[model samples]
Target: MSYDLVIRNGIVVDGTGARRYRADVAVADGKVADIGKVTEGARRTIDADGLVVAPGFVDPHTHYDAQICWDGAVTPSSWHGVTSVVMGNCGVGIAPCRPAAREIAMRDLVSVEGIPFDVLNKGITWDWETFPQFMDAAAARRPSLNLAFIAPLTPFRHYVMGEASMERAADAEETAKIAALIAEAVDVGALGFSSTTLNQHMGFEGKPLACRNASREELKAYANVLKARGKGAIEIALTRQVGVLEEDQCELLDFLLDESGRPVTFIALFDRDDIPEAVRNTLRLAAPMIAKGARPQTSPLPLTREVNMDNPFSFAAFPSWKRVFADTSKAAQKAVYADPAFRNQFREDLKNPTGFSNWGRVVVHAVRNPALKHLEDKSIAQIGQEQGKDGVDAFLDTVLADNLDCELTMASWNTREDRMRELLNNKAILMALGDGGAHVDMLCDSGYPTYLLGTWVREKEAITLEEGVRKLTSDPADLFGLKDRGRLAKGAPADIAIFDPARIGSNNHGERRYDLPGGAKRIVMPSRGVEYTLVNGAVTWEQGRLTEAKAGKVLRG
Candidate 1:
């Protein structure tokens, strides 16, 4: 029998947590035709000799809704062997927006996701307004990787409530209509709905995100829609402050699980340096909910970011930052930074022992001022000590001197290898929260799949290769119920990744690229040793480069 493509002489991990075996995988008609000896002639053949051929990595959390409009290839993630991604995470997206509310959508993304407003302005085509129409538009783009979407609650609330969605809880009539929209979105293609309670998720005009205003009754109603359907999952950005989860938050998790019989995946569980026992405590509190199909996602990558005060996304959690967000103009921001009142409040906020409090870990990344270049690698605490000022004062003064053009880097939690190993080994915790397609300039953690393999599996020996592949593949696919994906078998979709285990990983830092719309710059994390990536039997990425094959499908739940 003939085949469309044949991958020869490779070790197959199969993404099932099974033992690895050497096999020849053959594809035909966009499905795996055979996995044994493939002697038949094929139109294309890839010599994956000495490489590990596994199911393509699936990134379950991303914000590619805007980027997908322009970049059909969905780089960095695609470059790192990710064949599928779930977008519209954390209840922020651009669909179901009225023409009049277009600017509102873009501005919300700018504040919450750190995407440049001008970039979104130049990129999104906005050919559709309704949820199903949005799905159709995404499918029409013919992306290079499989794309699945969750109905973000913000836009539907905005569509129904207009300006008041951010101000108060929806009335009975508004709640019914909002629920109807979520149900409509699910009926078409949405996996389920996503909403956020994170205070850091500020939106247009420094207001808390519209979804944050959802009352418990409103959320219970939305969850019931899925309960009745019995075929969806919910992703929520819980009110988890760094590592702190209040009792009410725990009760909320239980309520959502009771309301929605379907699976519920929460945003993140990270190790915190300030509160050393936070991860363990949260896990203990979550143990009951987890037993009831509540999956808490965590990242293999550390929480490190290149912070520029231009957006100040890393500081959104600080109440003192509201002064900066209230007025985004360069002059206003400089004035706020120099204000003694603002500095005192910021310093007081810094004493709260969150991720942002570690001024010693914050270093000056880059500076445009040639005279201040000597301070480029110095820590904020070091500079504070040298100048006999507080760290917050030193940090802001440096930014003020540079006119907010300086770049500082803050490396926070999840760096402890011992803690990460314990987290990665937990079966109840799903591996995710990559935050790809968001934080465009601040970070690029989309290359985490390779990082898991290279650093965790190969180097640290935290987990076996099979377990690592399974975490990146079937675990996430199962979370979203993506059919016939995340595994290698006869009749399964031919989404595959082939790479050298010895050389698979990304660099410690990302390289900046002026590739966004309107010539905006974004940090791009590139991968090494990803030899080939195939989507639906098509070679989309071969030998460190992307091919022109648009084989992606807009996946429906």
Candidate 2:
């Protein structure tokens, strides 16, 4: 029998923590038809002779909700070897919103996630109002990679409670309505539901995000939606790390787990020097829960981003951040920065000490203007001293001179070497945290999969190639219950990546592009080693360029 496509003579890493082998794979009608060396004729043949063919990477966390509206391929993500992505991960998305709440939702995405308002406003059609309608609108489009979604709790809260969502806890009737909405969303197609209880995630009017105010009773009631379904997962950005959970937080988590009876994965366990106890303490919290048979996991991300004076999200702690993103165009932002009163206010705010990344540590990354070419690689403090100005003036002046286009990169703050090695090797951690489609200009983490393989496996030897591949591929797929897509076996969906093991990695943050709609720019870290990426038995990318194949489907629960 003839097949549609064939990948010949490749080292096969089947995305299992097993031995690697050599094989030829045949694809037909968007599924893996057969494997092992074959002379069978085919419609298309990829000569992947020396490459390592493995299951395509599945990014368990992303925020591509708005970007998917305009960018079907979801660039920077598809640019890497990622074939599947889960969006609406951090409890922020644009559905189940009333018409009056449309502006609120768009601005909320801008403030919380760092998506440029122009990109969100101009690119998104805002076509759907309900969760299922949003799903239908998404499925109608042909994305280049398989996409799944989780019902975001923030919007659901806003939908039912309106202006009072954050002021107080949902009343019993409102809680019931919210639970019903979540259950309906799961029933329609959402994989599960996600929420955040972090104080830092401010929503409308500079308060902690709406979900942060959700009562324990509200969370347990909502999580029961998953219990009713008998399948689904829980994603939470916890109030504190699992190890540092207070009695109230622990009770809430335990209640959710006992009532839902589903996998519970919380956000983040950073291997930080200041928080030396975070890693071990988190594991300590998980041990008893696991013994009692609970699926509790945490994953850290390698988050690096480019910053500029015009980007409001980077230095949001700065008092004038809202004023920075107050306008859409570069000229308008320049006008805001140029105002003497605003500049004085910014100077006052800068004089106060801030603990985040220091401006003295930021280096002038690139200079687009010919006159400013000599300023490249100089620290912002140095530039400030050279210009006889203070830190804020020096940084903002440089950006103003360049029309708010100057990019600055910070010191690689997190991800200590010893810390990443331990975290990557922890089989129980379920490696994740690629905030791909959000924070377009500030951060791009879609390249995490290739970075893990290239840096950890090939160069550092923190983990073996087999284990790294498994972490990137089948591990996440299994955790999310994505059937027949993560492993390279007969009858699985033919989503695969073929790359040179030695060269498969992500480029540095220095690279960027302006391909988003309406000429809005985004930070893009393109992958280096991936040669071919296929989705559903069709070639989507080859040799660092996308082919015109929209073979991906909207995966539903």
Candidate 3:
């Protein structure tokens, strides 16, 4: 029997944490038909003579809900061989929204996810009103990679409790409504439920996000719906440290795991010398829960942020910055930079935490400033010494003069290589947290997959290549119950990547020009040595270019 396609002469790592073998894989009707010695006639053939064939990476954490609306390919992530992605993370999603709540929800997303509000306003079609409707809309659109979604708790709270969702505990009626919405969402194919209880998450109005105010009881009720359904997990973003008068964050995890009897994953677990004891304490608490059948995992990498001060979304965490910049019209923003009084206030604010969060003591790593273009590698402090101005003042002045569009490099939180290696080696922790579709200007961590292979495995030998592949592919698929994909077995979906293991590396980290709908600017990073990427038996990408094959589907489990 003839096959539709064949990938020939490659070393196959079957995503089972097993050794690799040289083999040929044949595909027919979008599934792998044979794993070796495929000599049959085929419509297309790819000569992967010097490549490693493995399951396409499964990115279990992303915020691609908005990006997928316009970009079916989900760029950067697609460019990195992520065949399956789970979006609507951090309890922020765009569905189950009323027409009146559309703008408000968009505002929350813009502030919380660092997406430009104008981009959301101009780009999203708002074709769906309910969670099921959103899923169906996504299915109809059909992205280049298979996509899954979670029932975001913020919009559900807004849908049921209106303004009260952002202020206080929900009433009994509201609780019931939220639970019902979650049930409906799961039945309609949402993979799980997600919410954020971190203080860092705020709406566009500078108030705590809607999910932050939800009571423990309300959250437990939401989890109960998933418990009854027995099909979805829970993704949460909780502060590592809980203050007085609030439920300890671990208690919430315990409740969700106990009540739902399902998997509970949290946003981050970082490594800091000052917080070494805290990390140990967290692991101690999680041990018993896992022993009792709860699935708890933290993001394997440390949490980091990339800030671009020119964007309103850049100041999302700083109420003062929001107040200063949110209502300023584009023309007015340009004018404020020229005003001396406004510039001084901005300079003064830069010294404070609010301003630091927005525009930190970052160095001018890459600059378009004509005055400072020669000092691209110098820090603002270094440049300030030459100009005889305070570092803060110099940064503000240069940024203001550059119309706030200049890119500055700040030191990130996750710099400890040893801790990163420890996290990667942990059996329980899943090495994901590539916020691919959000924070358009600040970061392009979509290259994490390639970075893992090249830096951690090949170059540094921090982890074995087989272990890296397992974490990127099979582990996430098993965690999320994606059955048909994530393995290169004979019967699995033919979502595969062929790359040179010896030469695989991430492309340079920088910004590229990709015009989204409504002319929105998005930062993207392409990968090197990724010879070919196949999605569902079709060659979707080959030799750094996209093919005509559009065989991706909206995957639901």
Candidate 4:
């Protein structure tokens, strides 16, 4: 029988942690029909002579909920050979929203995820009002790559409790209704539900996100929904300090594992320079929990971001910084930055020491006023020392001079290569949390799949190519129970990535793209060495360009 497509003469990794071998892959009817000696012709053929054929990377963490309403291809992630992505992470999404609460949801994404509000206002189609409808609407879009969803808890809580969701824990009646919504979503197709308690995850009006207000009883009720179904996983953003899991955070993980009886993947386990031993300590603490399916997500890339003064997301963890979000107007922000009292408070807040307090690592990336061009690329600490001023004062003064149009570089933690290797190689640790569709303006970590393949597997040799492929593929697929995906074998769905391993990686910095709705600016990292990407047997991305095919499907649990 003839096949639909044939990939000839390539090194096949197959994505099961197996050794590579030269083979041919054949696809038919959107599934892999054969994996060896495909001599018969097909509708299309790709000569992948020097490429590594592997299962398309599965990104288990993202915030493409709103972006999907506009950009069906999912951009940079698609460019990097990722055939599938799981969005609605951090419990911040644009679903289960009422018509009146539309602005509230958009503002929550703006505050929590660094997406521009105007972009959301112009882009969101708002075709659905419930979780299942949202899933159906996403499917109807027919994106270029496969899309899976997690029912974000914030929108559900907000739907049931309205404005009160952000203020207090839900009452029993409210909790029951929210749980019912989640249950209905899971029954239809949601991989699971996600929520967050990170202090940095402030929502509308700078309040702790709606999920942060959840009491233990309320959370248990939500988890019981998954426990009863026995078919979904839980993703959460825990409140940890300086990359170290505090006692309370550890207890929360244990509690979730006990309550859910399923996999509980938490956001972010990064290395911290201020607390150098934080990673090791957290890994040691997490060893026992690993057996109980507690996976902490980390990234292979360092934490570098371009933070604009208008949206200083890197500093949102500080209590003093909340005032910046209180009034978003340019004039109001300029006044706040110029206030001596505000500067003093910020200085005092730095003494407590979170990640962004390291002025030495913060540099002046760009300036609107050419007169201040000399300040570009100088660390805030260095500039402060040169001017004989405090670092906070120097930093704020520089931005104030530019009328808050200055962009600063935040190169915070996760720089230690030794610590990163340990995290990547750890079986319990999943190399994810790419945060692709969110933070569009701040950074584009969606290029992480290529970064992992090019850096860790090829250059550093931290893990073998086989293990790297498995981590990016089956591990995440199994975590979310994505059936018939994350492998390049007969009978599996033909979502694949073909790339030259020798040259696969993304640049450290992203260039600005004016492609968002209303031509809003966002940083995008162009990939290197990804030759082609296929979603369900269709070549969606070929040689750095997206094809016309929208072969994507809304993947459900």
Distance from true position, residue 484, model 4, in Å? 1.2
Q: How well does each candidate superpose onto the true structure, as a TM-score?
A: 0.93, 0.86, 0.86, 0.92
- Residue 60 lDDT in model 2? 86
Instruction: List CA RMSD, all candidates.
Output: 2.6, 4.5, 4.3, 2.7
Which of the predicted structures, 1 or 3, would earn the higher TM-score when compared with the native?
Answer: 1
lDDT of 4 by residue, 322-413 (tens): 89889889988888888999888988887775875578888888898989999998999999999999888898889888888988878777
Candidate 2 lDDT, 1-557, residue by residue in tens: 88999999998999997888889999999999998977899998988878999999888889999989988898788977889998887788898888899877887788778787888888887789999999888878988999888898999999999978868899999999999999999988788888887767777777667777788889889878898888788887764532244556555667678878887777665554445566667667666555533443433344557776554455767787667766757778888777888888877776654333356667788878889988888988899889898777787788888877777776433456787777777777767777877878766767878887888888889898889889888888876668676899999999999999878887445366888878877888878889999999889999989999999988887
Off-target runs (Cα >4 Å) in candidate 1 are: 309-349, 371-405
Q: How do these models rank on lDDT, best leading?
A: 1, 4, 2, 3
Better candidate by lDDT, 1 or 2: 1
Q: Which prediction has more favorable TM-score, 2 or 4?
A: 4
Give me the candidate number with maximum lDDT: 1
Q: Which scores greater on TM-score, model 3 or model 4?
A: 4
Q: Per-residue CA lDDT of candidate 1, range 439-505, in tens? A: 8887888888988888899999999999999999998998888867899888899999999999998
Error of 4 at 198 (Å): 2.0
Q: Please give the RMSD of candidate 4 to the true structure.
A: 2.7
